[model samples]
Target: MDSAVDGLVSQAARGLHLRVAQLISEVEQRLRCEVPALWEYPDARTSEYIAEHIGTILNGLEDGTRLGAIDPPAPEPGRTGQLAQYGIPVGAVLRAFRLGQGVILDRMLEEIPRRTNDPELVGAAARKLIEGANAYVDRISERGVVAFQEERDRRMQRRLSMVQEAGVRIGTTLDITRTAQELADLAAEYFADIVTVDLLDSELRRDGAPAEDPLLLRRVARRSVSEEPSASVAPQQLHTYPKGARPYRALITGQPSLHLLDMPDEPVRGSIPESEAGALRVHSMLVVPLSARGATLGVAQFFRCGASLQFNDDDLLLAQEIAARAAVAVDNARRYTHARATALALQRSLLPRRVPPQSAVDVACRYLPAGARSGVGGDWYDVIPLSGARVALVVGDVVGHGIRAAATMGRLRTAVRTLADIDLPPDELLTRLDDVVLRLSAEASIDTDGEAVEDAGTEGDIGATCLYAVYDPISHRCTLARAGHVLPSVVTRDGTVDLLDLPAGPPLGLGGLPFEAAEVELPEGSLLALYTDGLLEARDHDIDAGVARLRDALARPAASLDATCETVLDAMLPERPDDDVALLLARTRALGARQVATWDLNAEPAAVAGARSNVSEQLSIWGLEEFGFTAELVVSELVTNAIRYGRPPIRLRLIHDRTLMCEVSDASSTTPHQRRARVFEEGGRGLLLVAQLTRHWGTRHARRGKTVWAELGESVAFPQLALALPGWDSG
Candidate 1:
């Protein structure tokens, strides 16, 4: 190109650089009108950026650089990226740059005509100046567009990452509080400066749908970037929002909304305290309803505090999506909590309320339900008073969890008590219980009409384990039998603990397996520990370790059976057991020779007189003289029937404990039944009269013999004994 045109263009560019401040002012004014988006930016920032671009262009022109070789300014790309981050359109940025270039190019072209009189030189300089300015704008605009696109892509990627992170982080557990806190923490990290999760009080309690208009909410969780306590509400605080409030409106409509707190008409000021409203006036808030499965569970509030960008449509949609997932999780946790609570209530109701008072053993028991996740299982313990100064210690566990297991446990416990009333041996009793379980399992497989259900899964296939033990103080022996249950531990009076060497029978419900009973002769004050397997298979330890711990605990000297029970549980169980646990501890008490009297008699009609004489003497000695007539009549009738209808040897025994007890043992397995006698009949009145004269009368059949026993009333108190046998009447 000609030096004259280049020199004139360079001189004009130099003169314009000297007037750069005025040029920048003119560019800023023109941009405010031509590119309205730049008005959102600060006036000083706009002026400074324009001045930088103009100065760079003029410096290149003054250095005699070629028109096509002018480079874009250093700050142009970064400035465009900042504008894109603030959500400004790229078109507006380029338009503002184009308009600023027009002002600079117009000034340089107008100055060139005055510096040179030659028409060709003036025209050439003006053309070169206009071409360089256009090249500069084109290059800078390209850089700005690239930066804007890159910023937009980065923002989109960050938002996608946040959504993916939310999917993984929230709802990680079946706990409502934990899930709520996760939602709050995630939102506070990615979307907002302050996040609060507020659930409807009714939803939290699983108490059906929420009320209309004004809603009562409990703040389950809250998180803030500043980590300071909220001025409006604290965590777990229950507060009510009026009808027009943002949270209330969002829940009522089941829609998400964005609100600018600086708006004078915003209703947030009515819901929060004046101090908090003042502090929040400069921020933006988003209220998203937590709706799932057609029900609105609660609302999540996200606040952009201080200089943070205001919440937009995209932020509202993202918050709504996150709240939707969290709502489902909260609902699941609420349902689980309700189910566990119901199962626990049913289990506690089915268990024994209080141990009965018996002469055989001093018993104490403990029952614990499973942890939160496992729900309530079916573990039960009971101390039932049996006939003839004996007591039954029962601990059983049903498979599965929730209401079905608890109900089945109740039925099994009832079956046990019913079978025990007949004075069945432990092995025979378990056999009967096994049959009952088999019947239950069969019934579960079929419907009421007896048709087999095709979809009946293992839900109805009932399975359980039980340990039944009957201890007799008179014999000082404990007969124990198990149906797929853990062995019972016996702690001797000398603090020696050993698990009973009982046969391991198949668990109940698996029919056709015979259970065997093991007899352990326990001395007076010996401790018998019967428990469900849960005690030996807790979460933290294996069965072997649990057994060792249990043995060690039982071997330690304790003040009483109650203390021993507590000690055993504390040693064996963790804070939150994975399964239900039931422990029964019984200390044996023997009836000494003074508390009982016995005699053998001939199997003849005259034996009745000897039995009556012996019983009267025993009652008199035991200070139960008031019951002498009743005892004499009961003994006479029982002995007479045994000699008349029973075969072979017969013996009579009188227990002076609790109440006056008359017992007749015969070497016959035939059980006597009570019948109403005809008015004119002289025979068959023996057993009927015995039943009428005693408080309770029953016949317990043994392998080789049967005992017909009768107990007198408790109206006459014995000095040293308290005997109240169960009412297991054969009649």
Candidate 2:
């Protein structure tokens, strides 16, 4: 559009090309050392740059310097002139390069036709320059960090591998002090300073309630071992930081930590620097958090100083890495220790939480753990209140009593509670428990043998001996099942101690063995003793002798259960348990001023009338006039079930105070199940009627027979039925 401008641009283009070749040579010559990597892109923008910046640059120079040799259109004279856009030259651009400046060159670049150029090609050149520069800087900084970490991790693993070797010995150990010392020595040597390791769980320290601070892990670790802690830190400080302090939060939280402190002369707040008076020389401290399943144990620290040698970044990184690995090791150890503790706690929970005081019927329970420190045995006892104002006293031993045994005891104890809650008879309760144990065993999940043996026994794998009995207040009858266990002593009020003659039954976990219960009259105030084989299996005595020893121990003229149980247990078991011992005792309560009678059953409808008459006579003898109100309904259901599905020979008993118990035995061992119904069903409603009419009902294992029992509550009748059944449904 402008001819003068066009000619000048043409001339300028001719001149600028000459100038750029010169400028490139000059840049390469002078700055080759500084930026040898910088390169130019071969784009159309390079042509425009040569025509513009190169021409102006040469014209700006005086006579014949390298750039001045080129022909360039002169800018308008005597005016502060900006070069015309198309005729910029090279000397100017060269000067800009010498100043390490790109602005002038950048402005000149913008005037070029960039849209038609490959932007990516240009950007690629730029990024290479940036990355090369950044790379140089990072090598000086983070490279050392990487090296430090690798070295530290290697050293840590090497040291801890030794500790793990020590751990092999440690697991079977009763003394942890030597193991603790060995670990501490490793830490101290690697850190090149004083390293102190404390037992996080010391048996000696009885801290109130359990410590809330997860960082306070000594309880889980050492409390089970020592009576008092030998090493400890100041309780973790809560006020170390205020709310809203960050990265600072990491300081308070249970994390492995290292601290740099400004210590001065004279100890101040337990953190005085080594230069202080009478202070042990400690300059820098490194702490590593030790935890498992997110529970933090005590912090272990390494303290060193730069008084003689400086601590470098290498040392810091190495220290941090080693501490990290150690934290993991500590976590694993804590898990093993806590698992032991948890197992012990469960074992204790099975016993009385606190000692029971003197009571009428004697009760004594002593739980002797087999091995204490490295491993613990599980054995426990309970004297529980039963339905119908009786007492259910039980003693049991999970076989091979260690962690697995302890855990099994917990499960079996829970099973007992569940069966009792449903109000099962003693023999059938054992059956249900046996089923559960067998199922657990078959699943092959029970890890007995301290998990030392991979193929440790099952619920069926490890059998247990348990004796369960219910002593009734009205009849003073002790009904019991001894499942392949020691015979408990029965001491009558006349000072006669007799070993209960037990009919053989398989141990608890052996499925489908016939177990018969032996019922005996307590003769008013007889004391019964139950115990695990740990007592009988002691080194000094054969089992028969242990039983004889128990017989005499029961005749010790003991007044309370605690003494009786202790006397029998201590007499039978050794001071150091060869195995675990579980003991339980109970004294009988004489007939509660009322008459009790039991009526046997037959399949004939005549049996129903006989049952009703039997209930009437016993209730009248007990002076319970209201027994007629509820006794008829309970007897009717049991008799009716016997008449229909039950194959003959049922027994009904009316005890004192109108406690009507009706038992119907059938050839079928298949226990009766209550079918939940829609209100119209008539036939399956007998159990429903019995359940509503009675306080509770249960079943007992008889030889080739099962006794389904129903009891009358409060001598009263239920107002109505969900479904009324035919009268002939009664036996």
Candidate 3:
């Protein structure tokens, strides 16, 4: 069939064969310069391979073989493989082949007029070349499609793996900004040239209200794979965008957006200013909502510019998947932040805002709760102004942390204050506080059947430790006691720091243990440091090392009490203490001898008149004539009671400080009782008479016997002394 035509084709093919190298070179040069898609493979080796393939097609045509009989070149190895390696799509690779085919036919057709004068021969050669080249390009392009699809699938799998990895990395911390930054970084690394994450202001606030439309979005994290700066300003500093902006719209609609980021006619607007867009060289963008649990937390934006491909539906899907996971993480972080803030507030309220002004001691205190990870704990300190210008310095730590422990600490502090008001000794005060804790723990325990029970070792157990010290300015002495507490540190006037060798009683909740009081004569200007275990033990250091460090800090040259407290804390505590810390620093002071006056009385009623006259004269000499009468009457009654009820060695003393004090000491251990005597009774009213003339009166026992003391506020300024003469006999 058409044998003579085939021979004519063969003759023309032989002539074209001589110029095959010329045609191949022309096609290769055209592909290199004209086809932008093939520019990725600019290497000379790739160009040579493409050119040789064109030569194969021309050789098949010259052999006079029928189009079907001329087998298509067994898929040229790695010709399109280069395109797959560079992530060039199958369409781009095929377009390059089409361009090469055009170049070959055009160059050959131009040669037709020179090869033969006949128009018929010229048209016949053009037909043979076109048919062969078309078949050759189709086969090569088909193979390129399979390779490109495989490359796309592999890339998709890789991206999926990246998304899964990101899910693990993001929200690893319960911090909102950090989680958002993780999402942005991962997106820029795997998906886009530029990525920015914006969360709703309400979500960040965790205000528990529905997020409003055109939600106020805050850009928390942004990243750019390109070397260029993302914008003139950082994304975090950009803050909020207008209502109709692209990111806002995503939040309002809870739908993702795919469009040109900087397009003039694009529905997305106002998020990025035109100036910022130009700086970023933004061409295409995908804005996806970060939504989870039926609420939209934020929006994530990805930008592709320059040679990067435009955003497609597939890219939008991937961004949405990643955003979905990140949104949940962000929401969780927000909730935790809110809860932590609440706990922090509760803790602050439970702790003392300011220590009470202590007259006997210049006091400064610090209370620091654990960081967010460990939560607020039960550290507490108080400066209580006890009666008679004495102060009780107390520090306590409830075991465990959080709201319950803080509440327990508050209750214990209250108990200590109540016991202190009764003038109980330090050891006795702590002993009562322990009983209070044990009783509270028992009350907190309720069985499953709704019956009250004791859970001494379980959740109801309130494990706590405390240090209590009563500092008496009058005596210049501090009585220290501990309930499983760290011993107090004493910094002497000479700048020598030493931990008190006080006995460590069992912790407060452990009842029945005797708490021993350690009495020390604290010199005026000496420092007393009382603290909870947190000040002597933390995650980074043991109790012993912390105490040593604290000692060193205290041993420094004398500074102000406040400064000394600050130095000790800075030296012993870490940046973020894992345990709650509390410290109380006090400098002791005492009344000078000029501020005090004393008188010794006989163990007889005859001594009372002289004792009263002596105290009255002392008050007059001290410029406290205003307190003369109250002082004389207090001295008379106290001296009378000491002589009548007490054994021997009766003594009366007067001290003028912020208040006027009258103390009567006797060898007898009997404490005088104040009584409201009946009209018929002239006796049993001596102590009562003293109480009426003073602010307060109380009895404190000593080793020898006891001291009954009465105090009058100097400002009371009672009338002048009047000697009460009773039943005088006439001579």
Candidate 4:
């Protein structure tokens, strides 16, 4: 080699070294820190572009350099080969280089070409280039590693703060959406962007839509991160998205759908957003799919650039951690919502509708459900209209509580309506009801789990206490019967009184016990109180005490019947609302402000005509019209029964209260019972048909022989309509 050529080569090499040194210094200045060992741009872009930038900085530095021959700064600072600082992150600063796999290809392109250069320098230079490239890569990788570690530290700290905040802000589990939002805000703060969480589904909610499931709102809350995320739903705006009906693209597809869109630069929509904000404008972005169990809550998207660059992987990972925290919060909210809706539905289902508007009588009623919850029980009341211008009042209870209890209540309601359609008196209706109860009991041990009492007496013993009564406008007679139900309280213009009908029979479904309807003349302007046991059963008082309290409240002056009932219940059953209660107040006022008379009698057939005349006279005296026809029919049935099956000197008595009552005295101790009328038999049909025609008729023993009686309801509107000729004085 010539001296001149060697000198020229040496000088050229020195100049190149000086240029690289100046370039490195310029890059460090631009980065606002040391370039951290060696650095290179991704290779997908022209290496020429990188060289150009490097050359520009280098030439400018060289133009101002005092030493053009100095060896380039010892081939980048030499300390530990890889980055060791935990606080500074590697990926944080080098994030853009990795996006879309640019960094991967960059490393490949940068190494292969340089390693392949030359024959004389082949092995030695190849090894040297490889080692040098490794060193450079190590430095670049260290920066990213530092950045990632720093991000991890920040995320952990944020999570700890969020947990502490959750403990302070929402101490317990209550309210849906409220605590969720609070936790959501905390998540947003932790990740410093849009953080969302959607919880999983459990037994109640099969899907995400509120309409698809009654209990779907339960189990929506924050979940831990150790669990894999599921598809979730999140409204882009305020409109809460239920979830995806098809194959969800997010972390979840069921209720509370969401995804972990943690990185600010990583648009959940997949593209580097091409909106007003450019894709590359991102400083950092994070995304995490919030999920729990198998449910996919929703996605959480975070954004991080003020005026800088795309978000890094560390940021995205942090967003995911934040979403995990939100999952727990959402669960609480959904559970609270489910509980509240269930309570409301149960209460509404067990109440009666508004009172029907009518002229025969003004009716108004109200039912206030017990505030406490014990599963769900059934207690119901009804005002059923019957044939022949009559109305029936009934109230009953099923024995258990909760959803099952409510279902039983529905069944009982259907049964009561069916019985009402037949228009049977309380007793006969009860007999049929017993059959129904027997059938139901045979099917299962527990009736319907609420107020539907379990039939424990035997196979045919399904039981419920009820009070059935009929009211007639013409007679102003309220015929009421008690089936092991509470005695009713009557408030008269004269004073308050307990109209305890002694003929009350056993509850329905109990050994087929019979029921007897008891009649009382509701003198004009009378108030009758009918109520369920819940009204009479309280924490501190027995049913008897409750009844007494009701009576006392009714006695108070200057109070309407409905008002009195309400007041009494309010005063007595105000606290500890654990039982079901129902109350119906009927005010039967004879519009005419009329007067009437009543009498007693003994069973006797010989007194038939006289009893009829007595009843007729009584009706005339009371200013009631056209009683002769009804009187004849009433006497015939009463006298016939007395003579054929009754015994003794019969005394006849008449009643002018509402119906024309014909009574006969007799010595016969056996009370009359009605058998099904036969087509061939002549006599049994008499009493049977008689009992069916009138609202009510019965026998009661006093001092002497028992009395057989019949009541012929006065048809006030059509007085001339016979429908029946003079009975020829009947039997």
Candidate 5:
């Protein structure tokens, strides 16, 4: 601390300034080669400038200037900004300056032996050199430290801004996979060279508890900063983490982990997948648990690979913040997924498992709900078998979506079947359905949310649209009526498509309006496509365009009704339909003359005897001798009743398809009801005998009057009729 000694040291430093500068320059040049930031500067001029700055500092030391006043300039004008731009940490800059000091001292030590053989001069000169180097290094480092702190503060501000942006950007939608991927993408953009997001199985399970094992985590999202093509696809997503893996450990501990791969002291080797571990040459990794509400839902891993800086405490904090926000979004999505699954199951249970087989129509159907945004809706189709080889093909749509709409759709379907069984015409059936809907809308309090509508007539209406059509193989005609439903497309036998010219009646539930029915003569082998409005109405196209698209798809019929149904859906339904779609396609097949037998009977009791004889003969010829006795008995009883209590113009007909159909028509409009006759009753037992002798029998009132029909199964093995066939069949 002697002033004279300091002055002597300063003079020696000035005289030796050039030697010190040369020695320091040599050391700096070597160190810059290893330091990333220094290597980025313009070639030899950078070294020369550094050397001159050192010489100026040595001259200041000789002149006895204060350490603060003597500034060692040389890292160019904006060293702080330059180092930061090159991603060089302030520590690296300070290390380079420290290396220059060692070189100056080492050069002075070598000069001590050559300066003189006198010990005093050698010792004094060496002390001055060491003191000067220490003072200069101390002063310059202070400046570097200040600059470094400033640069670090700026970086911290920028990272905070990025974190705020990520909060707003990530999990913007309630989708589990998307939100996870967003976290990975954001991390890869700013903090990491590679990112992966793995979620716990419990967070994805419908029960909200892990299936089989709760500790298993499934990788849901992954990303890499490099765009280089790799031989292997990224396994960051859709891969499982072992129970004891690093990600799993992070989840269990609910803590962030930082591992520097190059450090032997860090104990995280063999922690990740082998392939991923091998890919890390000079990398640092940080793993943080995506935890929320005290539950660890998943973990996020960020890797700084290649030349990127190692993972530090600040980086870990940012990653944990991102993972925290992402965890909440993922949890929300998981809950929504469970709700969606429940809704889908309800919809499936309400939908028909398979279309009922009909003798008149070969049917195929398809129903698809709208995308995730809409969840499940009330689009439905059904094939109900009407009496006499006629089938009612129906497609309906409820006004709303989700479980409520589906429940409403099921109710409407049941109502249609109930009305259809009564043998009402298509138009009349819809009229009654509208009444049912109006009542449903009024009684809306019942919340018939999940009742499988066995009797829709009793339930209140949810708003809906329906297109009901009845196809008769005998007449080769289909009678269709609509209530605010889309028109159907009919593909003729010649493969020509035409939209059915039917009136668009008001949708169901809106009462006071009458629905009209239109009949089209479908030729044999013709195709009939009935669909709900969802098929013909979408955001991209109006009903007209949709019909046109459908017409084009069905222009040339496919090989089978199933194929045609698929083709129509593939063409008419958009990739992501905006609404639920229900389609029903049927191919018409007429009953040939060989399949039907008809007869006209006189309006007299004696005519019954002749009708029985004719039915017996036809059954024998058609190889239905097993049912000949039953047929004769049915014909006798039907004819006698038509003649005894009915008007004139009586007729009998028999259809042999899957079953034997015996129909008797008369001019009387009275409907026959089956009643339990007293043990002594004779005449009332006629209808009762017909009912017991056949599988089913019903009376349908026609335009002219009425037709009482009975259908018997193929095999009738019971004893002969006890009534002896109304005194006509002694044969």
Candidate 6:
């Protein structure tokens, strides 16, 4: 090129640089007309890019160097990459560059003819400017295309990775709220700036079908990338969207819908709160239905905020795919929650409503079910009032969870109460309960014809662990036995806490295993704690640590038994326990010598009259003159029976407690039978008459002898004689 042509090109380049702002404006206008997609960007942003392009061209012309020889601007590739991320097509970007190039070429060629009158020089400058402009446009266009493709591939990979992560992260637990939270967190981290998961209220509660017309939704989870809390709905909040709302429409149609909040036609004020709408005015939102197995479970909302790219068709599709995966998890959690709720209801119903009133101990108990993932397990505690003013404190835990475990627990509890009614020792009662469990396991395994069914070995095998303790206030002793259960703890009156030393028998359902009982004489006001293994194995499964913590908790002085129970739970249990726990705490009470009277009588018929006289004298002394006649009659019959059929060393004892009790014991293991008196026989009516006179009558066998006992109702005697009787008042 000639120096004159070069000088001309240089002059035009300087002139174009001087008018850069005007050039940018003209190029932007042309781009708006030719490449409408560029119009989506703000005017200032479009002008900034156009200014960079014009600057680069002018500098190359001033230096008189080839435009292709210089690298593009530092931000050129990134600018095009951003356009790709914003979902702009490469063709549209290349067209915008071409339009700006034409505008520059026209301005420079027009400036050449005005500056130089020579035809040769003007023609030479025009040709040079056109050549340089075309080279620059081609160079940047190639770079833009490469950048756009790379960005598109990178975004596609990210989306694919997010979908794969959703499979691993969501539905990790059988908890509806937790699953929803997992979905929201995953989406907010990768897919959107803000995400929310809302399910039908019925779906959350696992009740009824999804509502369509007026969608009743509960926000189960909400997540946002911003530090500031969203002005939208909160988690666990229940709200309803009207029929025409975007969320309602998506749920009704079972499809995803995208809304540009900045668009005038997409009014969001009526669909959402004004604050939320205002907050989202400059963003785009995607509402995707969480549908699984042909059922619409819920809806997920994704919001692009600040400078983030607006959601487009591909984004909506991705949101739908992610929501589809999450929907299956949510549905599974909903179904599992329904089953867990049913099992929990059954377990609670089968448990004791309230501890029965008894004078042996002041008791308080607590039962906690396992975490949602584990389902509801079988854990039960009962305070059964046995004969002789004694009470049984029992806690049992079945091996598995759900309805079967709960049912088995109920059956075992019933069996314990029945065995207790017979006044069996703790060891003997557990032995009987073990037999009951074995029978139950056997029955569960067999089919209708009494033949064993396939796959009935482990699934149908019933197993449990129980701790049964019988506390007698009269003797101030507690006899406790266990079938593979944690040892019971005792807090002595001196504030020392220790676990009782007892044999750890095999778990129930293991036939032929002998259970042993340990008898500990508890002082008045001593605390006894009976609990299942769950209480000791919940945290790290370190039973020693749990026992130490429990011992320390029990050692603390509490105002009441209920407070002690709370303290023990707070100390021994984690925020969420992994297993079922049943705790029973009892404070011992003693019946003083003044409340009981005993006599040793020989095995003679004459001892019956003396027994009757002695009972009358004791009743008068205890201010129970009102019950003299009934007591005398019951004592007469029991003593006569013991004298006739029993061995030597017969004994009679009377107890003044909640009820008046008379017991006659002899060195005979034979039990008496209550038979009807025929018209021909006069000898069978003594036991029958004794049963008719007392409120309750039964016989309990001991190792050395059998005791026949009867209890008189206190309704007629206690209230009238409470003030007159010394040391006979009910505590």
Q: Which is the leading candidate under lDDT?
A: 6
Per-residue CA lDDT of model 2 for 556-576, tens digit only, reads 876577777777776776666
- Candidate 4: C-alpha lDDT: 0.52
Query: Which one is best on TM-score?
Result: 1
For residues 212-300, could you state the per-residue lDDT of candidate 4 as single tens digits?
Answer: 22112222333222123232333222223334421123433332222223343324332222331233233344445555555454444
Q: Kindly give the stretch of ten consecutive residues in candidate 6 with the minimal lDDT sum.
A: 721-730
Ranking by TM-score: 1, 6, 5, 3, 2, 4
lDDT of 6 by residue, 678-699 (tens): 6656577677766666788998
Each candidate's lDDT (Cα)?
0.81, 0.54, 0.75, 0.52, 0.76, 0.83
Each candidate: RMSD: 5.6, 20.3, 8.2, 11.7, 7.9, 7.2
Ranked by lDDT from best down, the candidates are 6, 1, 5, 3, 2, 4
Candidate 1 per-residue lDDT over residues 315-382, each given as its tens digit: 77778778888898888888888888888988999888888777888888888887777888988988
TM-score of 2: 0.51
TM-score, candidate number 4: 0.50
TM-score of each: 0.84, 0.51, 0.72, 0.50, 0.75, 0.79
Total colliding residue pairs, candidate 6: 0
Candidate 4: misplaced stretches above 4 Å?
Answer: 1-150, 153-365, 370-376, 381-399, 410-442, 446-596, 647-682, 688-731
lDDT of 3 by residue, 204-225 (tens): 7776787665456777887776
Give the Cα error of residue 457 in candidate 6, in Å.
4.1
